[model samples]
Target chain A: MNLKAVYIHIGWFQMSVTNLIIVIGMVVLFGLALTLPFPGNSKGNKKGKGRK
Target chain B: MSIMQEKEMWTSKLRKSWQKTLPVEKLLPDTQPAYVASWIYLFGVATLASLGVIIASGIVLAFEGASWYHYSNVGHFINSMHFWSVQFFFVFMVVHLWGKFWMAAWRGRRLLTWITGAVAFVASIATAFTGYLIQTNFDSQWISYEAKDGFNSVGIGSRFNVTNFGQMILLHVAFLPIVLGVITMIHVLMVRAKGVVPPIDAFNAELGERK
Candidate 1:
């Protein structure tokens, strides 16, 4: 894929590869966020110590 | 009770109700529970930040008029910021919604909070759809033409004329934004009132201990 080139265009509105990458990156980040455990729930805090 | 005493009783009742539902400590807590220090929790804040940017950039765009973005470099930059902020807002909101759903966030009498958040998400979609129709570009024209059929099939086309630029612009800049804002405010207030839902394991642990 031409990363610098336009990926889609409608009239004057256009989406480039960069835009696609940013959007995909954000989606992936959000997905990854779902799997990560909260700090308080992690094994280190399983005993409920070291928490406010 | 005398009339003056009755009035005082009513005022005190309101004050007590407010304090009971949202104590000052709960409303602005200095510390959050450990489980709240999670990546998923951050998505809600991220969505709020994106909304702030979207609104600020949209204000600038609105002041410059619909066509100014196409003609001026600064306007184009601000417009792009507004566009991307909206994309980020939806992405974050969906992630937050999914995370909450999987966590069963409606537990612990929090169904109202969940419902308010869900309603806010739907309102945000409507706000975004109107925004697309007011973009003043080929995308707007094509989308209006295409969306009209869908609206007509749903029997709402007559009520919402997407082809009418004036109507779309007003909905985009004024009415829909106000609706989204009010809904979002209620969602946040509900969250504050209910407190964050505890993890299921914690609930189970408490139940076991109680037993």
Candidate 2:
């Protein structure tokens, strides 16, 4: 095609590459963080007395 | 409460409630004035005032006809006023955002206000983009086509047409205002609920030493 179309294609490619990379990085980091368990005294069922 | 009861005019209730008790100022206490930073907070009201001017000027421009707004001196003046109001709206909004940001004003139970305001900012930007396109001028032509590429690249082009006056103008005048108004109301209500955040304790300590 023409030089203008080529330039448009190049610009779009660069923008998509940048935006997609950023979005992917954010998602991966978020997923990793989500999978992490919080370090704490895990006392859930321990709080209750046994039923009489 | 019934939906119909909730729909009653606020002032109607205000008049009805006058026999009971006056309103309390501590909906959120005045103790957190420093968080709002005095006169600078007026910038938020100024932004709202400019939005008022925009709507008023826009309605007049619409009444005069779009082509008339382009050529008639009066229409042009009204359009210019609307343009300047948008400038003011943007400036005041930025200042308010900055002032709130530096205060770390979202501390305490007030994070929701900050989040809603951030959403409002996004909506306002969308509103401004539509405002630019609706003029259909040289600037509009360039910005419209150029902006669509960014959208088309991202795959939102199927839903939103950047060049269509019907969509953009309706969005600018109707949809955005309703959303912004609702969000703004929520933002204000949350702020009133949570009260302003306390000033930095270190700053208070410094001031105590000065005394």
User: Number of the top candidate by lDDT?
Assistant: 1
Quote the positional error of residue B162 for candidate 1 in Å.
Answer: 0.9
TM-score list, all predictions: 0.82, 0.64
Per residue, candidate 1 scores C-alpha lDDT tens digits across B2-52 of 866865797887998898888887678666666776688888889999999
Task: Give the Cα-based TM-score of candidate 1 against the true structure.
Answer: 0.82
Predicted structure 2: lDDT: 0.70
Worst lDDT run of 10 residues, candidate 1 chain B, spans: B202-211
Q: What number of clashing residue pairs does each candidate have, in the order they appear?
A: 0, 0
Model 1 bad stretches (over 4 Å):
A1-27, A34-52, B2-12, B209-211
Residue B195 Cα positional deviation in candidate 1, in Å, after optimal superposition: 0.8
Write down the worst ten-residue block by lDDT for model 2 chain B: B28-37
